[model samples]
Target: MRQNHHDGTKRWARWEGASLPTNVRPPILADGRHSSGLAGCKGGGHGDPKAAFAKAPTFSPDTDFRARVAAEKFHLCRTTREKGRMGPSKSSNTAPSTLQVHRTSDLRRLLADRPTWGRLACGVPFRDPRWLAPWWDSFSESAEAYALVASDERCVIRGVLPLYRRSNHGYRDLNFVGDGAACSDYVSIACRPQDSTAVAQAMAAYLMDVRDDPDHGWDGVEIDGIAESDETMRSFAQALLVGGAAVHAHSRQSTWLSARRATWEDHLRSMAKTTRRKVRRFGEQIDGAGGLTKRVAETENQVDAFLDELIDLHQRRWRAEGVAGSYHDSRMVTFIHSVAQAFFLSQRLYLPTLWKGDRMVSAELHMIGDDRRLYCYSSGYDIDSSHLQPGRVLLSDTLRELYRRDWTGIDFLRGDEIYKRRMAATPQRIVCLRVFSPSAAGRIRFETWSAGFNAKQWLRRRLGIPPLSVVGMCETGTPSR
Candidate 1:
């Protein structure tokens, strides 16, 4: 029997010593191993289901209970509201009365109602069955993840929002992970492209209603990774803020690299002089030194090798420093491989590798989203090739191709690297906001070191001193231009 703990809730499978529930499906563990403190699946996930993407399979939970649990959890989740908690709104109790979980069939109908849903609903290479299966259990319970259908008097499904509940500090919190930092790109709240505005309004209203529920169990929501160009997202954010959710903070959480200009040279001119010089020098050395060539993976089989090289490069880079890059695990590698395939087929995955003959010396895994080339991850020769600068060579070549392809800008997302600044890239700040009721349990303990009590914390950010909290939200920084 498996047992799990979430938000002060404990879940245990029914077991009569040696006997197990006849109906309980075995948990699908990602690997035979489980983390000491974290809940894990029964066994590791099996195989890469690339072919699964073609049909956009409907992901269902193992049982009816799992489904319901996921839905309930989502309803209890909060939306990213203002930075502070105020008195409950008079209409708090007037929000949506009952939350419903949309089934696969319902999801299909809603997608039919709004076709652009296809863009998001369509499975990508990176998407895995296991990544989504928890929602079944989550929605079934009043826990972490859930989904709801927006409807009218005729019971027509107008839209849907998938949400997750998380507690940070002393307060309960909710957010669209689609809008959180974990997602490489903004999570899409799908609607018919034509009803973008209406959908946004409906979502805002639903979130507001959810917020007003006393049992909502969250103080506020913190959606930190919304794209700058999403009008519907902007509308929803604005509505939430004006609806009394104050905009205590905002920042650019991620950057993008798009093909915009007529030529790569024009793109270079848009960067700093030092950056241009470095790229030119790197290119000259790579081209003049050996039969070095840069190539992108285009076939399914080629992707496996390309991904292998990516993982190897990342591990090699970090292992020396006693660190593990994000993709160090097999499951994570599998996840990236899945996403990369979908992105590649959509002309969205960019893997630029420098081949020194038959071996890859450096490589990068980038994503093509909307109109931008997302520089998601990279690994390459940094020391021995300091003179050769294989990484820079690969990056410049990639940028030139991106320019020729007419992408908007190269997004060097979230890192404060000297190379990024030298490229004339402007810093875009990503901010997370938290809120709490005045007297929630553990509230005082959570805020014992809050800015109100620690004036030095605020002064540190202004004086360019690092803030003291491990949580990124505690620091205050200026917004990017």
Candidate 2:
């Protein structure tokens, strides 16, 4: 068996600051979905250099028992700053002290002492027990999973960064990001308000130490998909830079419409004349189609039927075009079913469907959290029913309802489409970065070749590529967008 890094004696030695020298292994050129290079490492490129960095997450004691322990053992203090804003406070406060790093295994001990990990920031209540089981399961079992927990002796709660160790199949290169790729957003360090810096320090300490240690295998941590407004993202970026690691700032776009308007017309009027006309026309058609109705499934039990219908409609559309669908594979179906069920139970699922009388023609699965309504997956009629423009109507009506629910905006997720443009929702970029070490030079070379291999997949758009997906030759089944 691979050496257990968690043995008590070795663990104790690590706790007292023991270092294990690990050699950087050559990057492997694996053949699989990850290396096919179909998926572009797109999204944000580098951003401005002079922005003020957000302070790192620390620990707390009064309300944050974890902070108390860090205070005793690491002389850690809680600190806070707005996301993206950089430079020390101009008000003459002393410059923030340098943050430190901790190891991945050592994080759990900190968690044992604290009451819990960081608070779930989004509206979905991320820290709930329901999320823990599945989150941990994915982390432990997935080919890629890396986590760091921070806590004090006083409480089991402190902070945690649940990251994944990802490898691109085409490149055979490794990188890290939050656990769920297509399902989650707004990931950052979860901790008490006071422990921001400590959390940042711990993250830096852990990453730097891992890079320097030959035993711990990692090129570097590329914390992906962090909201531009997250303090942890800022702090982590600074900490990485200080540790002699390369840092890049990239921009991501999320489309949102302000819902605090006096009237729906007020919202509608904000759109360009062309978009407003399309939306208005679409709604009229839906209303004419035997009265379109909308429903929200309140319980997990209700989701299966909805998902079943969605899959049916989606499959029908693709098959009609002589293409494949996700439902064709039991594994894809099972994965979607599992994720949907888990999301619903956690009250994280926000699937809305529109039906004409008894016939369901359109559906959109969304996640309601972080005060943002995320457009996760959607499907609708392909029959070209002029009256029931199923897809268009569903989205239009959904927006009106979302406005009522006080959601700030809709992250239409990734990809580009005509419907997205009509909604006046702008596109945001999500860029992926690959950092290879001297040991993994082989992997880096493979990735460069794989990127080219994958780029050739665009030719098959007439066949069955996903809507605007980065296509690769190694990719088989169609992607259910």
Candidate 3:
């Protein structure tokens, strides 16, 4: 049975002791080990019938009982609104009317109604279940998925903050789930534009209490990939300060673009004069050849085939530089394959390749968001074709294609590569934030990490030394650029 800790802290009490109800694909505990903490999946999941990308079959749960609980939760939210605790225009600065916890699988149902959530949705790659579920299941042994849904008084979900808890370097790290692998971006505490700050503050207070609970024993909460301009991170940091907690913030970057220009020509004209000239010259060259062909993956088989070509070319390009590329890791390969398959099913996957006759020259992997923005996640081009500027030409083609479709923006995802700047409007400042409660262990953990971080910026990058973090040695510890 679930129990309530009727304190003033205002968090949902306990997750019932029994197995998680429905919609959540609860993890099968290896060696009969079950988590006793309430800050984890009690469970929440979406259905996955295709095992092509996933290593294991989906775990189905009992639906009738779970459905009843969900109904009650909605009723609770509605009841709060009726009592004037919330209003359509502005809500009281107090916590949201209701806070319900969900597992990873619930993301599918929540995001399906994009009319409401779409305005502040997580990136497309993170929202879809087919992609998220398989990538999530890959880390099931080490990761515990939890989503905090903040609802207005009228039972309308105002915000959803989904995170994962895992042990990293012997510390219990509660952070974004896909941070270590695929560089998930634009992860904000989702809410109506006006309510974003309030919801962020609300979650901050709740998370602090959860960490301070003697039984919880959480070492730290690291939130990575928040844009510098974001108000939610500010609200969260301020809230933690008010609660006498410590917050450490670090900055990374993601390349950004404003494709909302009137026309493709106008967008190109906005770039640096040299870049504009270069792109036009290469574009003309490629077009003049007349044999240039562009292909989009229209089927699952095509997505897979193009993905292989991407990996092959990507690795070859990096190997030529005497470095192992991102795809060298078998785990990253599996995760990418799984996500591509899932996105293909939803028709949101874009694998566009440039070919000359039977030879492929450049390729890119993209996801079009529910909001119609495109994110260029990864790409590759034949290294031998550097004289032809394969990367620039491919990107030029992509931007023009989006322009033709009337799309307004494209996020180049996480990277500070020189090419990203040559094409991007300006780089957005993203941060890695770690908030720790007033505990000795938490303090030690923060200070130690801080010292190491300082050392890296001061020594590693400055000393012309390549650290494991930069080389992708599985130490994807923070917001990577």
Candidate 4:
């Protein structure tokens, strides 16, 4: 049997001798008219059954017609079941709640719907408006709020794509608000899982619609740190591709430690024998060095002091390597301070300083997700206390405590540092998705940027250096214009 789909695709099913379900409509014939005969049977023919069957639509006895028909029905049922699970489909013309785009230039306007936004953020601390608002407060001097929000006909928010527009080298581009020096991971459209595809399609359509508007149009878009497995972002890219936009993607790996063990000892035992030994030795060394203690900033009043110490230590460590650290930028410092305060108020900040008696040995900036997972955002350690191995010792202690407390997991965030691997954190892939509008100007910009990026990659390979990363480039300096 042949069937036509609304999307202009055709599906063919082979039929063996089987009765069709009463509710199953008759198949459409090759002439695009419904056949009055029962499926798999000859119409009104009173001849020999074999002769009549020969003239019917060809069927293979090997094919299970009933099973195929059942499967098709199931697919239709599933699609219908999910159709309004996350509001109406954006592509449907008769959708009861058509998705609408609400563009805002003020972050405060977006925050007015904080409760809904937070729900849509779905427990990713970095994507929370609480985090992005602070980031924008500190970095807004260089960018304009261009957040795209999607709502249903009833004004109920379905998704949010937190972005800011910036002009670079005479071209305007849009980027995620919590990006740049913050180095946010798992960044993507904020929406419920069921609504992701519809939300993404709506957002993509909004972008395409505004591509030519003088005030709202953008030359390109660059979204980094989205997880490689994020179907929402993949759907968004696919939608843009279907709209003739040029999209580029790059993938990188992040490390995560499973922390679901019942006890700290059990967690240690699960690690490789060598790793277990190293963790023990590191703890012993730190203990021998005047015994280590962790001091967490339990209140907002302590946020600034803890953050200042982290910055000082981080800059010192990086300067020793002859490179300015991420905190070296004044804007970045301000951004971090603001983010720390906001996250602290939200009970997601996990700033801790490791001390050896009177000396601060290491500090880590972490964020707690709604799932109780810890995201190790950034860290700083006293290079002067290398013998004590402050970083490793602190990490070991942190993991032990989190495991004992029944935390879901601990992410090492981005980068593939040897220490993270030695600690037995598994790798997860993240990707950067870039799209150029389908306009002439967008095409020119994409070609120019692509050529330069390719040249950089070629040079890095020739020099035996690792591939370039958007995060690395942002940390080192402003992204290539």
Candidate 5:
């Protein structure tokens, strides 16, 4: 018989031919130590308590001791599990590696991970660093970049949430990077489809852990223009809910045109008869009057010229209505120029000008997605050409060109404008989600703001004013008329 102590547990064994028996249990001494069942044992048989166990007849102390101990431990573990005890089982499967969340503020760090970011961005043009970096350079004077990155044990990036932090009414506010005048649509967490939930849960836990930190904590977070079809963002929102966040979501509609038809004629045939006749008539009127021509910006100089014309026309049209257009601000113009150049270099910018003989009728700025869809971001049209419906003619011609190039669709991002419906664009839902941190200050601030917002909405309803537009109102944390 032999005995050993391993890992603070007294293990008893009866060795025979250098192997421990699976069911061996030697005699126990009064001091809670196992003893060799022999008459002259050096350790526990009588006086010396610290003495080692005496050698058995067939046991060699130096022969395969570790192997024997390991085998015994494995046997015990298996036996314990079989007897319905709580212990680790001997199996090949392993637990998943934990995800690590890192906070970064440096633009170069994001740029360094540009390839990974682009892959995880999954073809959304707004999520591209090329677009976001320029937006940050132009408009981030007051805000600080606070991006969250998730990675696995192997240091492979799994997700990235590009956000900017700012102070809002004595509370810290976090918003998506391209949220304001950039008007980015379909913004979401950049991650692979399979890792979305795991990454979200990890990020939510990290947010909870930091919610009370003096410098890094956030009181509120607002994410806008999340596509309703994005399961990843929905999972992320659900994770935040599980973390006890006060999540409020508002839904709005965006219009889209299916441009996958084989030809422009086929596309027009798919529309309603009345709409088809109107679209055809608009195109014919422009072509027959003088001559219709389309100019697409292919050089940097051309891009700058087109942008200038677009800004002038847009401001003139809106000025005629006694309002400043979207491009009135010089900062916005600068941001547009910078981002437009970046997109143009990436071969994603689409600036098309429609002309009627010698007069420019309309101009549009579009960005192409990796999925071969055109995002109709902004447009400017001559109010003088309203009678000829220059905007519609331009859209029709643009679709014709896109179809010839085998593009998939066109997105009339955000807004329920009558023109979108008139052009036979179908409405799709997008959500703006606001999540308040689970901290005391966050709760109070959210409640107070909610009450005031409710009252304002009620007053608007009573006074016959339209409810706040989510697209225009969410950017600045205030309603924009």
Candidate 6:
């Protein structure tokens, strides 16, 4: 349980009583996505995303809420500056007062506060000590991990973002903790809603200031999975540019399903006639064939069995497509297994298996988030059963059940594949950004990565091939544009 730090517990500065422009607004994407890395609405929106897809949704933040958040941060920053701790320029005129960055491990005492802890937990799932503890612990011997922990003037925890530095082919490049493995999609900073911009700017400035003599000097840092539509991503980009750093951004569209309808039939009505008909036909056919059974993992034994089957089936199917599945990496499998225990015990995990009499045909791993979003993390279906359309059938059944349970929405994690569009899932644009130190080594490393990345895009465009995606790892969060 987290406390509400926005309840005016801290004292306000005299500037708050002055005639300063109190016009800061929260950054909510016009497309209805909350730029703060959390969904703005609980479910179904009334705003017509065109008359064709009319659905009620959680509305955007009101002006009052945004004004309050903005005003609070502005006043606080001004107050800090007035004390002569930090000047308007990077050349600090006096010693800094409140803000300090710390390693992830040292944040326990700061996080002891209810409000701060809750904010971080909501930003990133703060459960599973095993998962959180090993966040910076990359299995690769070449990688070293740490998180930049930011605190404010009053010693209140503001934000934390994880980082991992490693020498990639003699080039020291700093990437995010889960970058090498694409398990995390929205790598947002764990900051209070009001302090996101400030914290991000501070982090960027700190990175620039200490690049020459960093704790561990790295050529470049890659911030991956930022939503292109998000203001926070833009803020970081702007901050880096202001500090005279080189930045490159690559973008992709991800899929998400809006589960705001009251019933399965109502949701189906919103889909194209062709898609709806196919789903109906597949459902009947699958049901008729050996009496299809949709079962969710319940007992501990069931969870273990289902996860193993999921990995096996997913691997087999992807192998047939000439790609090793996410489970191909022993480390990834181990990580998922390690986290599965906690998720299972809490019943937040949904491991669904589709069966035809005695044989399993499809398996999917899903995690329900605190914001009521259901993440369609990973799925695997028997390739031999493709003619049965087992994948679609499984997905359809899953959505129906999720709707019945009143889940807000379903995120397809990553990739805007044909099936997702066919299901009427909304497309959100997310980008992978790399920020480089203004050094010779940084330029060299950045160019190499950019060239390779461009070459892949060229090949895909010329060959009309599907975009390369994270093999089997995909996750849910609000930061994606």
Candidate 3, residue 168: lDDT: 78
The TM-score-based order of candidates, best leading, equals: 4, 5, 3, 6, 2, 1
Q: Please provide, for model 6 over 78-138, each residue's C-alpha lDDT reduced to its tens digit, 9 standing for 90 to 100.
A: 4333432221122223212234443432323223344544556453342223344434333
Q: Which candidate's lDDT is highest?
A: 4
Worst 10 residues of 1 by lDDT: 1-10
RMSD of 5: 22.0
lDDT of 2: 0.46
Give the whole-model CA lDDT for all candidates, comma-separated: 0.44, 0.46, 0.57, 0.65, 0.64, 0.55
Question: Which lDDT tens digits does candidate 5 get at residues 1-481?
Answer: 0000001122222221121211122322211233344233322111210011111112222223223323333443343234432111123431123455655666445655567877788887888887788788778988977777665544466788888889988889989998877767788878876565456555666676667766567899998877766655654554455456766555545545555677788788778888888777766654576477778899999999898888887888887978767877788888888878888998998999888777788899888889888888778888987876787788777767666788888888887777566565777666787888879898797677666766776687799976543321111111100
Q: Tell me the tens digit of each residue's lDDT in model 3 across 109-150.
A: 443454544554554556445555566666555566555555
List RMSD in Å for every model shown. 15.9, 14.6, 14.9, 16.4, 22.0, 13.8
Q: Between the candidate structures 2 and 4, which one is better when assessed by lDDT?
A: 4
| Alpha-carbon RMSD, candidate 3 | 14.9
Residue 79 in candidate 6 has what lDDT? 38
User: Judged by lDDT relative to the true structure, which candidate is superior, 4 or 6?
Assistant: 4
Q: In model 4, how large is the Cα lDDT of residue 197? A: 57
Q: Which stretches of candidate 2 lie over 4 Å from their true place?
A: 1-118, 124-144, 152-158, 166-183, 191-198, 212-215, 220-224, 228-231, 247-262, 284-291, 318-332, 346-348, 370-376, 382-387, 436-481
Lowest summed-lDDT stretch of 10 residues in model 5? Answer: 1-10
Evaluate residue 245 in candidate 1 and report its C-alpha lDDT on the 0 to 100 scale.
Answer: 41
lDDT of 4 by residue, 19-69 (tens): 111112222221122343323422111111112112222222222333322
| Model 5 CA deviation exceeding 4 Å by range | 1-97, 252-255, 285-289, 464-481
Ranking by lDDT: 4, 5, 3, 6, 2, 1
235-264 in candidate 1: lDDT tens per residue?
444434434343222343344333346666
Go through the candidates in order and give the clash count of each.
46, 56, 5, 0, 0, 11
Candidate 6 error regions (>4 Å): 1-98, 104-118, 121-140, 283-290, 444-481
